[model samples]
Target chain A: MMHINDIDTPSVLIDLDRVEANLKRAQDYADMHDLPLRPHVKTHKLPEMAQKQVALGAIGITCQKIGEATAMADGGLTDIFLPYNIIGTSKLDRLVDLHARVTLSVTADSTDTVAGYAARFGAAKPLNVLVECDTGAGRCGVQSPEETVELAQQINDAPGLTFGGLMTYPPRGNIAQADAWLHKAKAALESAGLPPKVISSGGTPDMYRAAEGTATTEYRPGTYIYSDRMQVAFGVGTLDDCALTVKATVVSRPNVNRAVIDSGSKALAADAVPAPYTGYGHLVEYPNAVIIALSEEHAVVDLSACVDKPLIGDTVRVIPNHACVVTNLFDMVYLVRGDTVEREAKITSRGNMR
Target chain B: MMHINDIDTPSVLIDLDRVEANLKRAQDYADMHDLPLRPHVKTHKLPEMAQKQVALGAIGITCQKIGEATAMADGGLTDIFLPYNIIGTSKLDRLVDLHARVTLSVTADSTDTVAGYAARFGAAKPLNVLVECDTGAGRCGVQSPEETVELAQQINDAPGLTFGGLMTYPPRGNIAQADAWLHKAKAALESAGLPPKVISSGGTPDMYRAAEGTATTEYRPGTYIYSDRMQVAFGVGTLDDCALTVKATVVSRPNVNRAVIDSGSKALAADAVPAPYTGYGHLVEYPNAVIIALSEEHAVVDLSACVDKPLIGDTVRVIPNHACVVTNLFDMVYLVRGDTVEREAKITSRGNMR
Candidate 1:
């Protein structure tokens, strides 16, 4: 058996203990709130973890794409929720094939997407279509509660589609506004005799505040599984809760004040946290050291502020700003606890954009 | 046979015509300067494209990591230059194996990296090591020209290591400063009877300014093949010169002012160009329209500036801010000509961080 330190540099390491603890804590919170936990596979992108989530009382797994859902299905996951508008012929065709193999639910904010879903699916094997409401996030969603019901009614009246529920990627700071927006939509949906069975609202920033009495039936927080620096910046989790980290080798000490690591944007990702937090990532070993700049293959770290700096050959663990994007960059991640390497998990759903 | 439009959304499309033209133009510039052109494979990560570049009069290819070089070597590429200080034991072992199969030359800034190379390699099959110098770029490199020669002399004296050359990733918009820096180092090396054989300097921003009558012999430019929005901002090429693009479908039209595409940070990476160029990408069909925000799987477009907006089912081409990082995000790219997809080229070097 190999040890965790024996693994090569610029490798993603997942603390299995933290993962298990994070999973349990989130599941316990959802259980207490009476909301079904649907862990988004985007965090780890490994089907094994998704199955573990299901085993630990998750209702289903949320996949962002058909390819991700297919990967999860291949890994023996049965229920998948794709929280996006499934468009185009090739993608819809794959969705149809995936629908045959698993219980799949998808969301669409427009009638055009609903029509596309209806054209492929029939009443004999109905495809559950959820109306994605904008809420306060202001990305892709129905602008109003009336628009949500209009799209929901279209799905209900369509040949093969069923108005499954409503979903939204809520605002970060003020999630109650999202809950209130969905509450209005849910009332409109109920008035149309189409009360949603699943009202999904998600964001790691407000994972603890997944509304209790409102329309949100399930919570889909992806980053809660592998809490990153971005979640840390939002005050959602601490550095101890961060399950994912990039183990990079200090390849060069360019100057007295600077150290360069092997993990750049290609390994750690280019996602950044908000102000008060600086750099692309935080060095776990040296808390004061900031990863100032990232080239494609090298991260120039500022070590001036640190009392102790890493040598040219020293290895350090870095907590990335965003865990989900970091998972997408690598082909596999090493699952470990302490110094032991448990197993290597393939990032199955990475680059499954279509 | 499949048409380019027949491919799914958020897929990387590389235009063969533009690629060939870009190749010819860059090679022609190199030939005019009497400099050996070695296109870095980081942009495409396709060994096929690297092989094409070699066939188009390129000296060899530049890879950032040993695994990337290994992929190109497996694709029948013989000469590979890794412009990085590779550290650690496992990476060194792989480097030895890769060195055995190809003519490999690597860069080292510190004695620690040289010692690691000397430990694995033998005097019988010596490894060529270049000294990386920090010209104005505040990244990974020796601090001064004196430091460059010191590292070079150390490599020259070390067992089983030959001082190959001097290389620098020059600061953008100022190529002369880099040339002057390398000239000082070359003179110092000559005085010490360790004159360099190959001097390399590269950056897509100043690719056309390959120094002549200076210490620099070969030039490496990664993004010149598939020029991105960043390169365009640097005034290297126009948007039409971009061979690579992401074809994304408009999955949702939430309001009159905003539309959302299926492409996001997952497909088109989160790398942003400097000011004056905003957004994560540039839409070819709607130049005025801005991709205002990006979630993991959705790019929210502000279509208010556009006279014609994309519909729910329309597909649009996007030029990402950094084409190299975008290539790292995908598994394969569709090689296209006109409306037809020529072939699906596997991004062989993607996720080859180790």
Candidate 2:
């Protein structure tokens, strides 16, 4: 029965109703497109949110870190997809342990990573391994369709390993290029007598546009559940669709045209918004105010164009540029319906970078 | 008893020998300047580091949040200063409780914050209050010496508040302007028949320049103990002076000129190195390699200029641009003397924004 004013300043607030709507939207989009949705748990980092996504018809969960996948599996998430290369002996041991607990799948970009996985899981259950393909993201992945097929062949031939699928983290809002690259990779795999079981493509920007005819059989959108300013700029959702925001108190009004909030890079995060949008985060009430700079614990706001400026001691909700990074900054977030708090949800997989 | 290679990737490593030297440097500088040093704990957020700093001749510790001060107080540090204007009822109550446990002092830029403190601690021990003067940093604090005197008068007239002194977080390396402003504020307060007990000014960049002629009687330098890339750029310390480094594994070699590390914005933080310096951090091994960009889980490195590039599975230590922000990104930091693990210290005051 805590009021909005009762909670301490500079805390994260999640609108439960908005979360449900966002989840439903993702589920409905997947259903309409006939795509199996595997929401990346790296965004929310909360098992409760993952469970909600699962209950809303997500086929499984995707995680970038072993620590995240382990936490999700421990929280009773049966199917988990780790779409990142798990290298080194220490990580392989954790991977094997997680494989025994859940229907686990992992991705690898190089033969060395695949070899490490095959050697470690040789005595255990057959681990599902996917070949990560580089589309347009320019991150970790094989260079060409031929390279992806070569890696897939290595996985298929390796002991105690199943050639699960092909996955790519495409550039935001550029699924067409990914579709073409994935199609070429799928064709190459088929021509090599090894078809990928699953063709996965992921990005929150182009999530709803993942067509049925595309090579992508599954979609993984991490930031969709908590649409941020970046998502809003991508034309995916509006400010009202944003579920999470930082409740910050204006600690200092240095001048009439400038004010500082309690939330800084520590709370709002240092993830810059995409072009055409500026500042750290969007102030819901003071729309014209731009958060120009942030130190460790202070967000300096430029209130020159604001029709009404926030006074010192007033609380304002700031929608950060990237909600995923913001969630990692806090230990617990408030689940709220309107102004009343429902409960506090712990960021279960927070700081699980390893 | 963990080996360096056995530890997980993307972990924070602290050098005890460097930390000891850093502590000695700050203490010796303060001792030579005839000023009491109060190191800010917001950088390390570890009780063990704070204790070590205290044992090395720190009069007290300073923290930004009450949560940090309370943690330090709990860890047995006696005196603490919170140099942020704390507003609202919920925080004021916590401030009073914190005052009851330790000798606590707070800074305020407005009369409203001072009034809140006066109301909360009217019956308790008189709370020491410092008038925060904005000396060219342009963040929080009063505008002029007159405004500083007015706030001092407010604190002195308040029933349970004692006008402790004046403090300012000056612009980096601009101690001259800060000294002039603080001197003006001090003169005004003295003219008003309220001689200040302490005059504090802090910035690690100009910490050594805070001599006896300056109005400042106390110095609080947060980043002096863990010099980072930015500190090196400021000519305050060299790369060898850095005590903290993030150990990261090269997970992907996209090409001969590029490699990706396990440490990203999550490990190294997104705080860019100040001007004239490029990249996210300084690579100790590959001096020519530039950390071009960082996603959530991958730090893209451009090794075009390096004589030798790092292969997949190779480990490198990165000295972050800002060590203070990097400290907040980790849950546990390993304390090391040479190659041996001294202990794993928990970041006790991390995420203590409230």
> Which numbered prediction scores highest in lDDT against the true structure?
1
User: Alpha carbon lDDT of residue B138, candidate 2?
Assistant: 82
lDDT score at residue A5, model 2, on the 0-100 scale: 73
Q: All candidates' lDDT scores?
A: 0.89, 0.88
- Candidate 1's residue-wise lDDT over A1-354, tens digit each? 789778888999999999999999888889888888888989888988998899999999999988888999999999899998988788888999999999989998888888888889988999998889898787999999999889988998987988889998888877768878988988998999999988888877888877543778898989989899999999887999999999999999988999999999999889879878999998999999999899999999999899899898889999999999999999999999988999998887788776
Stretches > 4 Å off in candidate 2 = none
Tell me how far the alpha carbon of residue B258 in candidate 2 is from the true structure, in angstroms, after superposition. 2.1
Candidate 1: residue B98 Cα off by (Å) = 1.7
Q: Give each model a TM-score.
A: 0.98, 0.98
TM-score, predicted candidate 1 vs. hidden true structure: 0.98
RMSD values, in order shown: 1.4, 1.5
Q: List clashing residue pairs in candidate 1.
A: none
List DockQ for all candidates: 0.86, 0.76
Candidate 2, residue A58: lDDT: 93
